[model samples]
Target: MAAVPLQEWERGDKTNVEIIGYGWRVLEYFHAEEKRVMVRLHLPADRDKDRIQLAVMLMLRDIKHSRKWLCEFCGAPARETHTFNFFYRVLDSDLPRLVVYCHFVCDMDKRHVREGLTATHHLMNTRFDGTLGPMPPFASFGKRPSGKVYPLAGSCAGCQHEDTAVDEGVLKRCARCKMTRVCGAACQRADWGRHKVACGMIYSVTFENWG
Candidate 1:
């Protein structure tokens, strides 16, 4: 389990987190010092930006990473909150819907659960609010609210994969040009090498989005 930085926990910005393992769709950020857990979700690629942002805001209000289940109160997407009795189970239910996900954990004791779904219910009961009713054996924080986790936006157009290189964990450079592949590195490299110097200058142009 990799340790999360202080700033990331204090300030939520996954620009420095490394999510190599734990499934392609899942993400986990660990806080060793305080034993805190941050939950994140995988947003669909084809979703509209406005809808995605709305889902994210809803997740924040309910402390959920994504909108896996619909709320009983309102037709709006449901999220996990400290007020629920079976919070952990509800949280786990949200994962399969999202393609990518992850969270921070302490030990194997809490790791073991029925299909990894019950853990969310347990965490909610214990951490969100102090209600010893039907509690599971674990560490602490059955009454405290867990940290917020958000879906990471943006990807490298170069590889077409969702993985990011900002954390310095995996330095993926352009395979053809041997330069950092931020976007379309392979295509740019091929064109630059064979197209001559004059041709290369043609692509050195930039355009504004709103202008």
Candidate 2:
């Protein structure tokens, strides 16, 4: 069911009474000026193996810097319910518009954290609500605009390795070549001596060509 806004949450106006359909469920809460919409989606309740595929889909739909959002709900214990949060622009749309989103699982178990990270990685590349597709160029809405690389949220070959920017000023610099990189450290170390003399040249073994 799609989310619906209510004057008060206790009134149960957005409560759903039917079995989940189309791998989705939705709920809503509203106050005087804004609304919140929450959607719980699963690949198929019948099994757990489909989560990876579900994650890929979720990741591919995450867009950078636009108004899309995630909804979150908090709970206790490791096995409790997963919650998400989404914001809405009540005055801007015909009824409400979901704008922000977050995911809340009960605890920080490795599996759950991995899922969360995967979803976040996906968000970096995708931004639509329900499908995997190309994202549109984003326009700034706030006073101080962001000046960072806002990549589309989707699967990239780079997600498997450790983040190059990990911990206390440990720059991902090639020792031999003295060049900076966003790719992981292993690639940098491998090309050190060879890259030193070839630095910044086409034949240089930069991280991009380490493979």
Top lDDT hit: 1
After best superposition, candidate 2 residue 163: deviation in angstroms? 42
Give the lDDT of residue 27 in candidate 1. 22
Give the TM-scores of the predictions, in the order they appear. Answer: 0.21, 0.19
**Candidate 1 structure lDDT:** 0.29
For model 2, the superposed segments whose C-alpha errors exceed 4 Å read: 1-78, 97-106, 111-114, 117-125, 129-211
Candidate 1 on 1-211: residue-level lDDT in tens? 3443344222232111111111112222452121122233333334344544444333332222111222222222222222222223223432222211222222223333222435545564566464436644444534324564322221232332334323322433334322223335463455344323222111111111101
lDDT of 1 at 45: 35
Model 2: lowest-lDDT 10 consecutive positions: 16-25
TM-score, structure 2 vs. true: 0.19
Per-residue alpha-carbon lDDT of candidate 2 for residues 92-195, written as tens digits (9 for 90 to 100): 33332222233323333335444653565357446535342332212221222344332211111133132332332343433432333324555545644434
RMSD of each candidate relative to the true structure: 18.6, 20.7
lDDT of 2 at 89: 29
